[model samples]
Target: MTASAPQVPPRVRVSEASLNVLRSHTDQLTTAVNLHLEGTLPWYRQLTTDERASLRLIAQRGIMGLVNWLDNPQTRSLPLVNELLGSAPTDLMRSISLQRALQLIRTIVEAVEHRLPGLVPVGDQQGMLEAVLRYSREVAFAIADVYARAAESRGAWDSRLEALLVDAVLRGEASEQITSRASAVGWGSTCGVVVVVGPAPEQADAAFMSHLRRQCVRFAADAVVGVQGDRLVLLLGGVTDLDTGLERIMPSFGPGHVVYSRIEGSIDQAHRCAQAAYSGHAAAPAWTLAPNPVPADDLLPERALAGDDTARQMLRDAIFAPLAEAGNGLLETVTAYISAGHSLEGTARELYVHPNTVRYRLRRVTDITGWDPTEPRDAYVLQTALAVGRL
Candidate 1:
């Protein structure tokens, strides 16, 4: 006959007597853990009384959970461990980071291990120790899982709030609610802000958007991104150089025109910036030779032709009004220059002045309106401004 396999004893488990002993000492163990944390962790000592009490309650629950798990070794303990920490208030939970939570768990386990010799019989002591080790491991994992889920939920909520704020700015709504939302998203910048608009990427999912946001941070800027249909809108803050910042983040946009609005003084005025960017993005297709990351102001003529009232008013105010206000026949020279195919001699002939006078007036036009009648793009913008001003 084949030799029979040697019998193996069942795995050791904590006895009922030891379970009762551990249960009675749960409060003692909790106190030990809290005292250890207070003595060892500098951050713990800084917590308010209520916050410390909250942590004390968590430690008590953790010890109690360990006892219950020891009583029924096969029972699921992760859920119990999860519930123990899940009851913490949002602020309290944030105060105790994962590292600190794990440190507390280790302290609790050590407290029990230190008292095991007196609490249980020698045979049961090993089983109790093993149980504590197993339970502490589960508790560590539970802490990590809970914190991860909290981060994910917070991220989703923040994304929603960010999108809502972008929508409000686009709608030109600057109320207390908008301010509250901006604060919720940590947009506390009183510095200049701007809005950028482009086509949404073909795959504008959470991952892509997250990467885009990271890119913004890498460039030392803050951004709130919103995808409205096929359009991608971004509200950028704390940028010192708009051109350099835009160039840094240009790759985040899709394969279409990327336009940024004029910088507003602060987030409160970002709605005006958003209006310009929205209008520019809508009219971007009209300018074939426009640069990839063109300024919203650069597209004023196209936006005016597309019936953007704000763009029309902007052109009229920023371009036409200044030239019209400045005397010395600057407006007449600009009109005559454009009408004469940007010919200085032709304009001089029309104005019955020397070409040098026409050239001097053209220089004045550039200085006054920030646009030149000779450059093709500036000519178009000036011509549009003149038309809108006439209208």
Candidate 2:
């Protein structure tokens, strides 16, 4: 069965109650826009029925938040619109009213037709200046009010929404709706998705975010964008792991060690995939994304650790297997050997052992694992495996 249709909100109730405070502001806006347009508007001017309904639905979504903020002490100052406006906004804006709001619109249109110096005049030229200042202040506050409510809303519901959005996307049905939804949720047009595991920001601090964005850009020059969360899902449509890719980008990200997940498709799709790649249970790689259906191997802490864990079943066979078999400190010796790039002199200096002793242990590793350091390639592979295993 088809899902039930969304409830249609009554304009009267919305304008008078939840949207009451915004009513006067809306009236003011209507007057301002009309004056600029001239007095040719028909009576009963309002958003087209469809636009009205859409705006109302959007407003109601916002109002639910306003109601919650009113109840919250930490967020009490959040709804300034209610204090500035009211629950019973005047009907002056309704076309049937033909009232003060309409009068203001008429006045501005007349002034414009008469070639008034500016858009709207308050009274005398002095009033005009004052009106200009007052109008500007009101408009500025209104913009700030919208953002305040938005930021508050994001804090309360974004995690759930992000998850929902991701599901909708993965289903392959909401591609067109994605951008609009992202904007509604406060993901700015110019943004990035970072996948970090150590910590996620409780609040996206302006300077910290700027630093992150700036650092990412410095490396790629608009090559990357991100959305912050448990995984810093990133969209790297602009950079790749080509010879100069990392060279052209990624210098500013001071080296604690990080990997850029690869993505394919439009920047927007890249944005989504970046989240998916990082969101999955693995550590990202320090290389380019290989292609569609991305690798099944997720970079995880357990897999990246520094030992041969693939055959743990053999452990009890030797009562700790290699651990017991090594007898003293073979793991430590091998670790040092790997870190020193399998150089006998370096491992000896680090371990305070004779270089000959380092060689003997290296030979022993070959005996146990059937992998030998005598071949330089095997040594490199083992070292990388060990590093990830440790991670």
Candidate 3:
């Protein structure tokens, strides 16, 4: 069963006599706040002259907000404080935290309450103290409301900035702007990174992103997730194992093709990795028997078939060039092995060598290209790489 929504706080009413007492001493209350801040808050002394002035202004506006809320007790307190604090410069909100702002409110409330006995009549003093407590509560809620809005605004802006950074990574655009943006989104320059691409879930929204972030935290990883068209791209960092990380995050994506790039040293080289994942994602359907979370390199045959030059060059460099460099008849042995229907004896016969020599050369082939000629899948990739390199 679903839970019920929280009820709103009840509005508090202020007595007419207390309201008059507060209105007459607005300047006194403001001065009291200033003196209390200087004596109690060491950080207040560290603020710039303009920042101090802004704080004083917010405090003064806060007093006026209380008076206004008192005048129209039935009106919402949120609008009352928001309207008052809205006049302060937006930058002030950044300089001050919610806890510090609440401290500021407490000081102002205490300063006002301290002077009540002097300004208010004896009969009205009790009423004045009660009004002060209620007014303080309302002010506290208003301050909380303002900060909540600011937090939401900051979160939205960060999400957009992160999306732009991911876009730059995918498009292979290396610029100072990309670096600056990556830093802004907390992407460490030296962290190991990988890019995962797949179709996005249907209801991709703030809640979904929050869930994805929580998953990252659970796995001790950092990520920037973006939805470009139907594709959801996640740039994961601090991951020591791409395959392990993929296993944990696989449930976050919709079914279809999910491809992860090999771990890269830094985000700067992430674009190269992202390109491979992007190309592989497009070509993944061709590999009907592909694993759920397939490595981008595993799709090299499909990528090469789709005319991706990057994939073609990757195949040539990773497979063909290594064998060619080893020389020692390794290249011919590979060709002959596949041509001999992966028969060790047949390749030995074709190369006019002992069967053991063919076995040793096949082991050397595995060491050179990290692919086993005996495995059907590895043999297919090797055959494709040789064909692509020759073309």
Candidate 4:
């Protein structure tokens, strides 16, 4: 005959009598936990009556979960900790912090352990004590696992909602849905909103966005970002200065010109801002010396040259109309100055005016248009705006 293998008993082997004792005293274990909470935790006293009742139910379930684990026939069967704790209202999580939840768990476990000697037969005391300790550990792990899963689920849903909001802005879809969705993503009217457009970095990981979010928080801003192919777009709010906020976040973009929009009062209006930034970003390469975080309005010359109607109209409004409306011979003087190859003496001699008079008019031009005629960069912008306005 073949020799039989030796049978190994399970780790927990509570006798029928010990199981009966635990079942009969489940109420006692629960009451002990309640008394411990009332005596030890001051915060517990602040909770509403309903909240305290819900917590008591959870404690009761935990004690019964231990009893079920001890009496379970399958040696390797784990306690149904999740089911026992699942009946607790979801609102409890919002009202009670995880630290407080852990405190409650610790108190309940201690109560059960304190009463374990009387609850179990003397011969089975040590095994029962050890089993209770192991079960409590399992309960703690289960609580952590539940909270982790809850947080992961919430994060995933938020990401998808954020993607949809970004897509709507990129597509220029303004509707009631956008307003409701914006609120869901934490956008509000009180904060200044700005849109930033740039090329998405190669091989960027999710952690890159995580770092970007932390940076935004440091600067007292909130951002909703989406990466579409090589394009990355962000709608940022809570910033008093768009330029300063972008300075903190610009390092996360890929190697290319990034464009920022004018700050608006609300994110609801940011789709227009996003459109302008994207337009400028498309025309950004035309200005080789453009700063990394160039303002969308600053790219008007290039954008207008690229046949953007808004850019053309902007040039007409911001540059030509202002000079035309000032009417101190500013428009005629500017035309003559550019035509004179930017020579101060040449412009004065051609216009039959004193050089000081021409210089004074140029200062007036700078004040009206926020552009200096002598600087090469500002001169190019003025010349382009003049050419577009005349057309």
The numbered model that scores best in TM-score is 1
Candidates' lDDT values, in order? 0.81, 0.41, 0.82, 0.80
Which ranges of candidate 1 are over 4 A from the true structure? Answer: 1-12, 74-78, 82-94
lDDT (Cα, tens digit) per residue for candidate 3, span 1-391? 9999999655555457767877888888888889988888888888998888898888788777777866666657777665766766364576788888888778877877787788867877776677668777877787687788888887778789879989988887876776787898987647677788999999888778767867765544667888889998888888755566678888889879899885546777787789999999999999899998898999999999998899999899999999998898988998999999989889989999999999999899999999998999999999999999888
Candidate 4 per-residue lDDT, tens place, 1-391, comes to 9999999755787788988888888888888889988888899989999899988888887777777777662323223644655666354476687778778878877777788887788998988888877887777766666666677777667777777888887776766777778888876545477788899988555667666767766655567777777888887777665567778788889999999885545666677688889999999999999988999999988998887888888889999999989998998888888889999999999989999999999999999999999887888888888888888
What are the candidates' C-alpha RMSDs? 4.1, 17.1, 3.9, 4.6
| Ten-residue region with minimum lDDT total, candidate 1 | 83-92
Query: How much is the lDDT of residue 294 in candidate 1?
Result: 88
For candidate 1, write residues 98-198 as lDDT tens digits: 77777767776776688778878888887778877887887777677777778778777878888998998888785677778788899967777878999
Which parts of model 3 have CA positions greater than 4 angstroms off? Answer: 1-20, 89-92, 217-222, 240-244, 263-265
- When summed lDDT is taken over every stretch of 10 residues in candidate 4, the lowest stretch is 73-82
Each candidate's clash count: 0, 26, 0, 0
Better of 1 and 2 by TM-score: 1
Candidate 2 residue-wise lDDT, 1-391, digit = tens:
9999999532111112323333324344444444443334443245466443332332333333333332331333224334423321222122123243334334443432343233333233343333333333332344345445555655446444544444444344455676555555445434333322223344444444445545555434342233344433323324323334444433433322234344434334544344334433243333234222232123322223322243122222321245335755555677788778767789889999998888887787667755566675445434444443344
Please, what's the RMSD in Å of model 2? Answer: 17.1
Error in Å for residue 234 of model 4: 2.2
